[model samples]
Target: MPLRASLRPGDTIGILGGGQLGRMLALAAAPLGLKTHIFCPDPQSPAFEVADAHTIADYEDQGALERFAETCDAVTYEFENVPAGTAAFLENRVVLRPGARALEISQDRLTEKQFLEAAGADVAPYRDIANEGDLFAALAAFGGQGVLKTRRFGYDGKGQVMIRAAEDTDTALERIGNAPAVLEALIPFDREMSVIVARDAAGTCGAFDVSENLHRNHILHTSTVPAGIGPALAETARAMAIRIAEAMDYVGVMGVELFVVPSPVGETVLVNEIAPRVHNSGHWTQDACLCDQFEQHIRAVAGWPLGTFERHSDAVMTNLIGDACDSWPDILRDPSARLHLYGKTESRPGRKMGHWNRITPHQAGNGSSGQKS
Candidate 1:
């Protein structure tokens, strides 16, 4: 059932998966007089620090899930990997924004690609790999240069391997544990971009400015707004995002990563992947836009009016991964920089500790003012 009314102040919103995103969501909700309850298996979830309540139980814990759902007026997730069964169970008891259908489509790479293609979105050529024979055929079909990614639970380059040649196929498959995977033809693109879009229960939609992204070691390093793409291509990206959100009957913030491929006529965008929750690339909105992505997501899921998606400033967001956050003191010392640190005790390698956004007045032709430090 669709959400019939806006969630009033003081209503509790339950969040699945406790991480930096959930922590930020909890912070965003508090200012609107909304409370958050975080549910995750990790006892040291950073979101627990800001949330009004928390549950440290496994996702499959039925009793715990029911108890947690009873305390909230609505539910949303910070990550796409929330167990499908858990989401289904909660949908019956609480309002789960973006719905279980979105989760089901995004959890598997093959499913997500197929859904994008069916929706008239351009996607990289892909083949499903259920066995060694299938993998070999896919490698040959893609000219022996493709990425073999696990169909599920892969992120930040963890469950993927690049097959640069025929001889690398076995090694690539081994790296992924020979699990169910998808082989995607490597895209030769000009640049990578993402659009963060929101849709409310009322079917109203809004999209933030497209952001150009740079990734290092498979993790996002920085996101710059005003992507430098021509206005036409940017609008095209936004329209594609709206179409996707509408197709899924989505009711929250979604991040659609896209590859901008240069064609003879102009630039064409291809769907790379979809993130069902707040995305790393959208972090720049925290400082650049009147209504940040986090707040927009809260507003959407709560059945409230969507906030302004207009960006008043050009900004660049840099993620503090692992020990990169050790420079927090230096970042705080810089007056022009806005620092946001996730309260994680240890900064293990490749872990996203937090991020900072550097803002500058928006200029018509100058969007690259902020430099990553």
Candidate 2:
């Protein structure tokens, strides 16, 4: 159910994950007079430092979940992998924005693809693989080159393997732990982009500018706004995101990743995947837009009116993965560089330690021009 009344300044919000996303969400809530309570099993959760309160317990801890829910006006999650039982447990007691249905669809690759296709959205061709035979057949179907990704609990290039013709299928399957997986045809796309949109209980929606993304080792490296796609294609992507939000009756921020395929007539956008929360690509909004993605999510979950999604400048946001954050001093030297660190005690390879957004004056008449960085 939706919130009966907008959350007041002092109402505490419960967050289900304690990563950097949760940290950012807590920070966004503070200025609005709202407080956050982070629940995670990890003692070193970065979000715990910024949250007003925290519970270090497993997601399945019944006693802990009850106590945490009792203190908040609403609950939301920073990541998609929140155990299904955990989400259902809270939905009955508190307002859980975006709800369980969105989680159910997005937690599995096959389910997400089916949901998108049913909603009339185009997606990459895919097949489910349960065993080696299934993998071999699916590989042949895709002409022997595709990506095999685990059905659940995978992100940032983890839980996946690439299938190349003549490669050992057994070795590839073992890499994913022989888990239930989906084989997606390796789409030869011209570029990748994403649209971050927010929807409220009243059915109102708002969308930020399209962000062209570049990835390295399957992890997002940078996201730049004014993604050089022509205005028409950009609008098409935005419209698709809105359609998805409405289809899910979604009441929070959603990140819709798309693959831009070059067609004979023009560029076409295909739904790559759906993230049911604020996205890494949308981080650029922190400095460039009047209402950043984090704040937009807070407003939606709190049942407040969605804020304007206008960009005041052109910006590029780069992820400070692993030791990349070691250059904090150098980044600080540039006055125009707006830096944000996740407050992690230590960093490992491919871990998102932090991100920085660099903004520039919006060129005259090119208000929303297309550019790639």
Candidate 3:
């Protein structure tokens, strides 16, 4: 049977994948009078603690999936890696926000680049590296130094291999295990930034202030608002994000990651990637904006009017990964800090256990831009 004509406050929202993102989404839904039911393969998933209900089942379990569908007024996934087949299965019974097509494009690096280019957005120069021969050809074509990233299942520097001229090309390919991948020319960028924008079915769109991102070991470590790239470049990035969201006819939040490059044509931007759901970079919005990205996404997906994008202060957000969680007491003591813990069971190295944001009166020169060196 089809989903009810429209969701009411008491209606349940079903979420796929249980992680910190889902936890935040669940928290956002409650005040709006909606309850959440979480489903994930991991029985120890952290998100289950706060959700109104949960189901521990593999993504492919048809029986469990049908039950979940029957319970939910609509479905939205926390992570993009939800299997395409699973999405297709659930969409038959429930309304899946952001839609399967958006998920399909974002889950694969190659297809995402193709889609951006087709949409007339600027992107890094890339070529498919299907095998060793293809890698060699791409290396030759792009000259020294390119990034070889897996087409699927890559995040936070995993599944990515850097091809420097000094490194043995064959060995690098072996390290990557000959996965289907895309090789992109390494960008010489002044800074890396992202735009988190949301759109609804009514064609209304809103963009959070552009944020400058700093990475450590290819994982995002900190993000700050008022990226200091000046108004023109900021507007350029936001426009790019709006175009991508509208092109997909998306009905939720999306992130557009880009490189701020300096060139003879003056500084310009290149699209690095797109995230079809709430993004890590926009975490600062929790303290700085009137409506956080999570709530904005919920509003859009529920067919409600989009919220205003009013940012009250400039803020800096830092991820508390692994041993970083040990500083929780210190973080709590700081009056300027707002902390969020994921309720994760253990703190393994490099795991994203939690994060904290510091809201201050917008200082001008605080190491604001550039990819982490």
> lDDT tens digits, residues 174-250, model 1?
88998899999999999999999899888888788889999999999999888978877887888888888888889
- Give the whole-model CA lDDT for all candidates, comma-separated: 0.90, 0.89, 0.87
lDDT of 3 by residue, 201-299 (tens): 688887888899999988899998888688778888888888888888888888899999998978999999998899999899988877899998887
lDDT of residue 39 for candidate 1: 97
What C-alpha lDDT, on a 0 to 100 scale, does residue 339 get in candidate 3? 92
Q: What's model 1's lDDT at 85?
A: 95
Please give the ranking of all candidate structures by lDDT, highest first, separated by commas: 1, 2, 3
The lDDT of model 3 is 0.87
lDDT of 3 at 51: 95
- Per-residue lDDT over 298-324 for candidate 2, one digit per residue giving the tens place of the 0 to 100 score: 988898878888888988999999999
TM-score of each predicted structure versus truth: 0.96, 0.95, 0.95
lDDT comparison, 2 vs 3, better candidate: 2
- Weakest ten-residue segment in model 1 by summed lDDT: 364-373
Clashing pairs in 1: none
